[model samples]
Target: MIYDLIVLLRQNPTAEVCHKSIQFLFVMNVIALAAVQAMLILRVWYLFSDQKWIQYSMILCFVACNVLSLYFTIMASQNLKLLNGTIFDLGKHGCRASRPPNFYRMFMPSLGLHTMLYALTAIRALRNRQIFSHAPVLKRLIRDGGLFFFVVFATVTFTAVGSFLTQLPRINITVIYSNYLLSLTSIAMSRIMFSIHSLASNLGSSTEWLLSNVELSRVGWRKGRNENEIIVERRCAGPDDEDYYYDDHSVLDIGGGRDDDIELAHVDGVKVRRSYDTSRSKSPMPRLTESRVGVYDDLTW
Candidate 1:
């Protein structure tokens, strides 16, 4: 902005200086846009659990957009010329693009990419409506991605239209605004990533208690003083004959529970059977499980 002000304040600024500034701005915009797209691709990849087809499709879109952007950028650069005017000029003093009326077309690919990402997120959200409806992270992912896409899509669309209409003034303003939008997108994505990580951590911690306590209690077992043990007793069996025995170091394994070692328990007066595997890993952090719990159960954690 200071550089812009300086250029505007200068009288009879050299054409070379103006060209360099334009080139620099164009390069910065391209890099920023690419970075924003990369982040969006990553977000989508995570949203889909890194599905190969989805990742490849996003990559193809990125490549296509960059290729088209490159072609249009080269054409614009080749046709770029300096002019003396306050209407379409980069500066009020003496800096403006004299040619390349279709320069705004270069940004159309970016707009399209943003739209594609937005659609992907929306579709994913809709398809996984049951999952996202209950999951705050998924909902926020869609919300943030949509908001970012909307802002960028709107700006790029307006800029593209302005370029088509040869509204150089609008194009000039939007060029600057495009960079601002890129920054905003980057910040929004970063926040979403942070939010997801935090939510995952919290969910892991909270679920560990359920996995150990509630699940064990259903079997008439109480958590022992040590984290690695639980005391079990049969409800119908007499105390003297009942086996108070359980693995002393039976660490709860949260990952796909052992299918064969199913234990039946009376949970809330309803019989329920669940599988649990013992963990040997030293790390205490709970693992994400793939097993599905019964309908009456809170979760198969």
Candidate 2:
């Protein structure tokens, strides 16, 4: 579409063609910028998943940004004009747009939106700074989100500031700045998403990262007898890991005593228990429930 727009403008050089090109650029640029903001906002949304206010606030800002973008799209379309009130000279290779003094208003929404997103990401990172060591994925997310915000913020700022400058010495530096902005926006967004996609694909092997965010219920994981004299055996591996208690004969007595009621720890040190009554068949009523004296309440994370 960009290439075609350029070609059409150059070939025809008509007033209608220039007008439509501006409209098209405005619409496409708004969509691209909005998509970038949405992704950045979602990063904050996920980080503060339990905070209702944060989520609602981000949603409101996102909606406001879109509405402003729509309003400004119209404003820019009507306001911006072709440079020197003329078409692209075939000899010059391309056309240049002549923007109004207040043309920067069209990009104000993006600057404001990125600022808010960056602030939110910063505050959240500060609040959870202590957990970064334990949660590498979360740390990387915050880092990447901040970088994305800065890239967008700088893009918008440069475009807005460029509106104030004009042609110098027969060369317009800010000419076709909008096209440059679009290209940068698309490239940055794509690269970030590509990195995230690669990380997500390897999530299965990253159990520690998963455990850091996962909410495991202690009572829910207790498998067997409810009233067993449970022993807390903490290992830094889940049941699926080789280091789990299943392999150790001392934990499960096949040759002797069978009072094994153990609580296994999660990879992040949260405990979830499972018990087995091996000598249930030896009793007359079978399935004897062993109760732990003085410890009735379940442990919390």
Candidate 3:
């Protein structure tokens, strides 16, 4: 029963069959357009999360393009089927519903929109290297937008251009296959872009982690230096004739171990001089001084 039904459908008159097919295809195309808009939504969120203006502009563009293009594409498709049935080769009863000029006008602007989207995606990816480095979300946005643009742009451009040129009597296979070639090129570019985005994201994450660790280490090291140089107070007895004298405190590192000379001298009832191990010495020896100015001294031998 199913085999017979399939055969019956295959043998149906072309014009009537195409009219029905167009109706289904048109709906499906609208659904696909909706999916494209969804991709744009995701892309805008990822690419312009920081820029309110860009995000709003993206929403506006999506609404405008989808509303306009879908209406035109459907209208043009219906008009093509009507024209095919009534005007062109009415006597011959096969599916003669071919491409229409109105379809091209409706379709061309959509293709242009897609191309702009792809270029925008690529530019956003290049510009937001910082986000790509810090998060995978932005990278995915770039990839999705780029891939969607490439697929739709190539599909529409190639189908329209190649089918029209193939009508030429002595055309090359390359011309006929130009659409396929463009599809392949777009696919290749999409893959390359995806790979680049992935690598860029990984590098971004690694760099951020490294910088954060370095900052933490620097903070720890600064605290450690403050601990190393500590001031302390100590009182020591000074030497005097039959008298116990005292000296003011001295600074020392709490963790450091050094020997100090206890000998001292007094001046004006205060211990003014002391000696310590050269390795632990903290004071400079006094020297006689004389002042001179405006001297440019040079020695040449």
Candidate 4:
């Protein structure tokens, strides 16, 4: 009955219309496949940032799948030729083929490709979170794994339904629908990868700025507050009949001076005195007082 129905439909099947639909679907699927491959390649590259070996392994798996897919496509084409008489069946002349490469060959391989790609995406996302944070394992799993499950489940459901209910003998709706799902997945994954990359770059920039500021502050504080001994030179002409001159140099600790006299009561191991110089020729000796220097003759007494 099914074959009869198919034959009945085939009696008046519009070759032109089917041809155009197939062409449109073909173009869409090709573009979508290309997009998916590109996204996977980019994700693999991202993994190389931390795990080059893992990235290489991923690349190898992807390459192997593609190579096998290509081989199957070729084999399927040859099978069509043996069974249906031609491989390039756009319409009437090639319409008798039992199944095009799209139905069993290309489409089957797509299942594996999309699955692996999504799984890897999820793994990388989880790994990145794990490395960067100390968040609970369950939270990270729920975040990353949940997303992966949603995407994979959606793709699988759509592909299965479209494949099962499609007009298989004439049209492989699975391929069309798979292309659509893959396109969506590709877009979502690509956006996610781009966002992650941008976030990491901004974080690194912020951390670098913070470190530099800390270093600068340390240096500035050191320059502003460090204690250093400074030397002062003084030239004095002694009172004499003839010309007489003497140079006096003294070293004072810049930070050793007190802001107030009370703070200067203790000077490490040295006793406090009103003046260190006792040369009467330079100036009269100043008496020391608690409040005012040179105000008393014997204030300490």
Best by lDDT: 1
Q: What's the TM-score of every candidate structure?
A: 0.59, 0.62, 0.45, 0.40
Candidate 1: tens digits of C-alpha lDDT, residues 162-221: 656654556665553346555666676677667656544543333333323334334443
User: Distance (Å) between predicted and true CA of 185, model 1?
Assistant: 3.7
- lDDT, residue 183, candidate 4: 58
State the lDDT of candidate 3 residue by residue for 48-90, as single tens digits.
5567877777677767777776777677666653434456645
Best-performing candidate as measured by TM-score: 2
Model 4 worst lDDT run, 10 consecutive residues: 217-226
What's the distance in Å from true for residue 173, model 4? 3.0
Q: lDDT of each prediction vs. the true structure?
A: 0.60, 0.57, 0.47, 0.44
Better of 2 and 4 by TM-score: 2
Model 3 error, position 80 (Å): 2.5
- Candidate 1 is scored at a TM of 0.59
After superposing candidate 3, which stretches have Cα over 4 Å from the reference? 1-9, 14-17, 81-94, 143-148, 159-301
lDDT per residue, candidate 2, 1-301, as tens digits? 6554574457435566666766776677778778877777767777787789979988898888788877867776786676524554434434456654445566677778778877888888889998775554577678887787688778777775665455541222452343677677778788777766654444322323233334221211211122222222334333432233221111111111234455342322323343555463665432422222222234322
Per-residue CA lDDT of model 4 for 26-89, tens digit only, reads 4445455546666556544544445777767767766776666556545544443212234544
Clashes of each: 0, 0, 2, 0
Error of 4 at 108 (Å): 2.8
Q: By the lDDT metric, which is better: model 1 or model 4? A: 1
